[model samples]
Target: MDHDIDVFAKNYIYQKSILLTKTAQRADWDREDVVSELTLHLLRRRDQFNPGRGSWTTFVKAVVNNRTTDLHHQLSRQRATLSLSDPRVSRVAERLEDIERLRHHGVSIDPESDQCDRTIDLNNVLSQIPQRDRRLCDQLSRFRTADAAKHLNQCRSNIYRRIVSLRKEFSSAGLTDYWK
Candidate 1:
C-alpha cells in the first residue's frame, strides 16, 4: 500500500543520479520536466503493475529506467528537428579540418572516395534547387549568415529563413547524414 510515487521521483533524480546521465544532459531536460513525465507515465501504467510478479518498488524502478530512455530519445529527436530548421553557426572550419586530417594521414585524395561521392551527390541535389534561390545559396556558402544577408541586400531574418528552407531541401534530398 506504500506506492509513494513522489519518493521514487526525488530519489531517481538525486541519489540515482538520473539527471547526471549524459543522455539526460544531452536531452536538455529539467528536473521538473523529467519528474512530470515520469509521474504521468507511471500513473497511466498503474493498472499494469503486477504485484504478483514482483514488488512495487521493482516494478516502479523498471518503469523508471525504461521511461527515462524513452524520454531522452523523444527529446533528442525534437532537438534535432528544431536545429535542422534553425540557422546554426557556420561550420566552415569543420570542412577545412576534414581536408587537413586527410592530408595529415597521407591518404590519397581520390575523387571516388566516399567523401567525394557524397560531395558529388550533394552538388546534384543543390543543382535541383530552384534557380531563383541559387544566388542566396551561393552567398550563404561563402559568408556568415549576417554577411550573406548584407550581400543579398536582405535582412538577417530573411537570410535565416532562406537557410532554414535550404536545410529542408537538403533534408529531403537525403543528404543530411552525409553532411553530418
Candidate 2:
C-alpha cells in the first residue's frame, strides 16, 4: 500500500509538472515558477485527491488556471497604478478634457455623436421620464399599435393611450424641442 501510494504521488507530480509548464508557456509566464507553485499546491491538496472520481491532471489544471488568472489581475492592477502617476498620462487626460470642452460647445470638429448609439429612436426624449414611465415608452416604441394588437392580442386603444401620456410627459419635460 505504501509503495502504491508513493508511485501514485510521483506519477501525479510528473504528469502535472509537464501540464503546468505548458499552461505557463501559453500564458507567457516563467515555466519554472509556475511548475514550482503548482507542485506546492498539489502537495497541499494531496489528501483531497480522489482517484475514483477524477484524474489528478484535471485538478492540477484547475489550480493552474485559477492561479494564472489571479496573477494576470494583480499585474493589471500594478500597471494601472503605475500609469495613474505617469506625467504623460496626466497630459493625455488634460488634452481629453480640452477636446471635451470644445465638443460640448458644439465646435463640430468630430462627426461622431458623443452619446452612445441608441437602440430606440425615442430614447433621447424618453430618458427624461421617471423609471416607471420608461418601461411604457419602451413597449410603445418596440411594438406599433397595429402590430401589437394583431400579434400580442393587445388593444390598439391601450397603446394609443400610453403614447398620448408619454407625449404629454415629453412636452412637460421640455424634450420635444430637443428633437426639433
User: TM-score for each prediction?
Assistant: 0.38, 0.28
Per-residue lDDT value at 34 in model 2: 56
Model 1 C-alpha lDDT per residue in residues 1-180, reported as the tens digit of each score:
445566765576443335534455542456666667777777777678778899877887787778877876776666442233233423444444555566677755565577755654566676688875788778766887789888889999877787778788888877777323
Q: For candidate 2, list the clashing residue pairs, or say none.
A: none
Residue 34 in candidate 2, Cα distance off native in Å: 2.7
lDDT of 2 at 163: 64
Tell me the lDDT of candidate 1.
0.66
TM-score of 2: 0.28
Query: How many clashing pairs per prediction, in order?
Result: 0, 0
Best by TM-score: 1
Q: Which stretches of candidate 2 lie over 4 Å from their true place?
A: 1-29, 80-180
